[model samples]
Target: MKNKKKIILIVIAVMMGIFLISGMLKGKSTVEGLVGDPKGTFVNVGKAVTTDIQTKISATGTVKAEESEIVFAEANTKVETFLVEVGDPVKKGDVLLTYDVETKEGLQRDLEKLDLQMETARIALSQLQAGSKQSIMQVQTEIASIDKNLLDVEDGIRQLETSLVIAQKDLEQVEKTYDVTKTLFDEGLAAEKELDDAEKAVMKTKDQVSSLETQVASSKKNIETITMQKSNAQYNLDLLQNKVQDETKAQNIAMKQNEIASLVLQKESVLEQLDKVEEKVLAPIDGVVSRVGAKEGSFVAPGAELMTIINPEKLVVEAEISPYYAAQLETGLTVKVKYNGSTTVETEGTISMVSPVAVQKAAQDKGAVSTAIPVKVAIDNSQGLKEGLTVDLKVVTSEVKGVVAVPLLATMTDKEDNNYLFVVEAGNTLSKRMVKQGAADNHLVQVSDIEDGDIVVTNPTEALEAGMSVSYMLLEEVGE
Candidate 1:
């Protein structure tokens, strides 16, 4: 009976020792956490693993062709010919169409007529510039002839005056003689034959005076007619000279300029007409015609989009990042892009632009902190993309490799704006450690105070405090 009691006491002591060891193991703590039974106050936990962490923001955008342009015809005309068809490749300055001669013939004729008129006007102007010097000479000669004629008229007038004067004097003398003779005859102091002779002499003198008067009148009329003729010639010469100086020359110069302007307009019009006459649709760039809206003989107007061309060679994936995350984005940052349907076909790109403004989809929605900013990702392998394709873009705004970081849940902020972490020390108790924090993308924050194997508490609560006796469990093991 003594031997059995001693054995039982030994077993009891051993059981007590086992319990103590177990309790000691459960309470003992390390930087990571206390090594304990898998259950205490059961709480989910995460590890502060060394990982190459990347800060990213995601947005939705469509693939756009790099070079897209719209072409239009300028003139108001119908399509006359089509030199190429849809999907046909075209170069710069290639003629797209040719117009029917019938339609343009009328314009051509009108232009020709204008050309003739313009040329005639130019010739007339030239003639004016020459100033009818030959004609002027002829006029001067005629003027000289008129001057001579006028001089002759003046001379004749002078001669007629002199003749009139002479005739008047003779008549006076003859009258006196006749009066004396008649007085003698009436006194019968003279012979009857002598009286008869005196009568005849008086009659002859009177007739001679009448004849001289008629001759003078005729000479005066001749002079007056010659003078009138000279004046008419001078008037005609002046009219001709004025025509050469003013009307014909000026008209010709004006007409030449008009013709030049018209020719220029016609050239432009022809080009415009040829452009409108084109019906062939060609690829705007070295691109794939992704869409064809109209076909041959289709009636279209300006600004009407007929087809869509996508230059897969130049593609960009546009993304709309939230304003909150956009502040971290910048140009020339690397990006990872994945098509919505084909996530496996991944491509790399670079950030081309970061908008400074924030955007919101709905009026009532909370505006994104960087909502107004447009984040463009220039895809390197743009040839693999198509227009209107949706892509998922992950822009690596920042990254840290092998830095001491804690899960965001492990951190707590107090009213004093102090950021701290509850780190497991000795005896399953958490010690609050104030840490200088670095960048935090979202759920992870970088800390300089923590080391590679430091134990940080996850899911911190108010009940947790410094130097408090707390039971804990190991949620995750440290990874290399």
Candidate 2:
């Protein structure tokens, strides 16, 4: 038991010793830097004076394709065949798709029908030209025949008049016989039957004479009608002959021909439509099929989309700038672009176009975002550029020449509204000097109170105080 107690006591003592040693080690490590001097000491900063200063504004942007387009089909038709797929290179006039053969053949038939219709229209137009030469000749012949018929009618009227005169004489003789027989019968010098017979014969002769007179009158009227008709026909024939002599007839014919020509032109237009209907959709430029909106057996309406063709060779980065900065930005600005884990490249671009109106960027929601108008930057062909690359844009806004400058670290600002820095004098002693500072950048600053050859202490908090002694060190050697 005594041996166990001794061993326990020894173990407890060793534990206490280890804890104390660890605490001591941690304490020494934490406080060692505060108690001792740093392995690397002060940075000696030199005063940089004003030279030519270029003012610039920085902006971040992305690259996009300079040229892009969307294509569409012309007709609503079933897609018969798709010739090319995405990424397939095509040339101008290449067939993109062939619709169903049935539809195409129908269109061809329609075109042929249009041609036939045009021919028929031409024939109809030719017929519309009135009074051809052959028709005029036939009219003249008919008029001559009518003249002969009129002469025959006049001769028939004359003969009927002569016959009427002879009939009238015969009727007069019969009337005399009837009067004589009637006188004898009244005086009892003749038989009653003889008087009656004479009276009957006279009556029959009178009726015949009356019939002949009516025939004569009818013949005269018929002759007059035929003569007038012949005169009218002759007048028509002469008028048509005169019309043939007039230049207006030719003008009429020409006018008719012009109408036919117009119809022919209309027919030609229809034929062109037919031809266009059968024409296959062809690519206009050499490019890849960037987008496909058509498939086999799909109906494409008029101006329907088929596929998009893009030329990757003509690619550029287009950027938009705000109108507020538009006055400061001009054509031919230098730019730097970086892409795909690659090193940044120096390039210059020109302002291709600028929108007069303010255009909002993607970050804009409503009313004017920064009053920035859209501006396009044209990529300089001298630099090889690819699409879809992000770029950093820097624009020089203003420039100043020969200005005094200093390192930012060397300048100090206090609550008393004074800016100053520690300067190293000739005897290696530090002195506090008030300074006036100006515009600064990531690496350089413009200082007003320091001379060109003055030495300033960067990190003045290290051990710097007014009238303190120091050793001369080059800025390069001190790693400032």
Candidate 3:
């Protein structure tokens, strides 16, 4: 109907325009005929359209990636090189940047110095033990060798003494035989040759005894010398043990070991520092590089942002909803997410989760603070959505079937906090009636008092009091 009226108006305007331009028709007469009489004032009106008022919960939020992270430098250093640039896709542990490591050279020098110190300490300990021969094993070996030699000497002395005793007995027997032979020869019953043989034998026996006695005496002296030598060896061993303990050799060795350990610890500390100095920053998550905060060769402090990575394919919408409807909206419910841009884009999603805790959003106009519960929606196909894109959402927290409802603007509150609206009667007179309000969205609301197709003034002004007659322009109102 509106399009038809526009066509008729355009045709009439063309006719009037042609008539005035040709000067053949009187313009004043045409003007007077078009506007002959004045009309009374008319108030614009809207007919309540009978429609299903879905009890939806609406909110505005941002599009966020499920996997996202802001990379920061692990340590304070100058940026050396960026291995990847913005918009480049990368995996976890991929190198994003490297830091300047001039300090690593200094650390290496310190490590080298510590290495030299450790080496010197070890050599010093070795030198302290060199040629000392003070160990118990060494002393024990010396004593044993000396003792064996002494035993050999003593055995020789005993064998010589036995030989001497045998030699002396044989000499006595020969002497007696010689005396018997001499007596027999005097008696003329023995020859002089026998007596001479007996005498020679006796002399030979005496000579053998003399030689054995000399050997026995020499063996005895040797035994005495060997015993003295063994005793001296044992005394030297005991002296070495006492001297070693007095010198605190064991304590000295332990001290040297501790010194080397200290040097080793210092070396390890330097190496750890060097590792940090030459550290390479890696991507924390597998994602595309969305932002590059620092360029190559730029200096950055500790915890400074380097880049941002986000998995664009995995997307979610996070919205702050009123706590009143937060409980009604839970996970797995269908949702309509509208991304506002040059053109509004709407996509279907499911409620992923709803937070139980409330967060302070902002202060209301009446100095009352408002709290909101965080809610997340998972998009089925997030192909066109990107991270951080602001969007509007319509979450179907509830649904009322076959119910009477009206525009939310039609409702008002009295001092008693009762909800009411201006209901237009047949004569265009307004009447106020209390209404039982149910779930409401930004547009329509569920009400028990107002039935379907009821005419209610959406924009009731202060001048529109109870029982006042109104000249309403039907279908829609043009006034603000």
Q: Against the true structure, whose lDDT is highest?
A: 3
Largest TM-score belongs to which candidate? 1
Candidate 2: C-alpha lDDT: 0.64
Cα RMSD (Å) per model?
27.4, 27.4, 33.2
Q: Can you give the lDDT of residue 395 in candidate 3?
A: 83
TM-score computed on alpha carbons, candidate 1: 0.52
Candidate 1, which segments miss by more than 4 Å at Cα?
1-43, 79-284, 291-295, 299-309, 342-344, 355-371, 476-480
Ranking by lDDT: 3, 1, 2
lDDT of 1 by residue, 153-253 (tens): 67876876787787778778877877787788889877778777877877887787788678778877876787787776665466457733566446655
For model 2, the stretches where C-alpha displacement exceeds 4 angstroms are 1-56, 101-278, 287-289, 321-327, 342-348, 361-373, 381-385, 396-404, 408-424, 427-440, 446-453, 457-478
Pairs that collide, model 3? none
Worst 10 residues of 3 by lDDT: 33-42
Candidate 1, position 215, lDDT: 76
Candidate 3's TM-score: 0.46
Q: Write the per-residue lDDT of candidate 3 for residues 170-211, one digit (tens) a residue.
A: 888889998899899999989999999999999898888888
TM of each candidate vs. truth: 0.52, 0.45, 0.46
Taken over the whole model, the C-alpha lDDT of each candidate is: 0.65, 0.64, 0.73
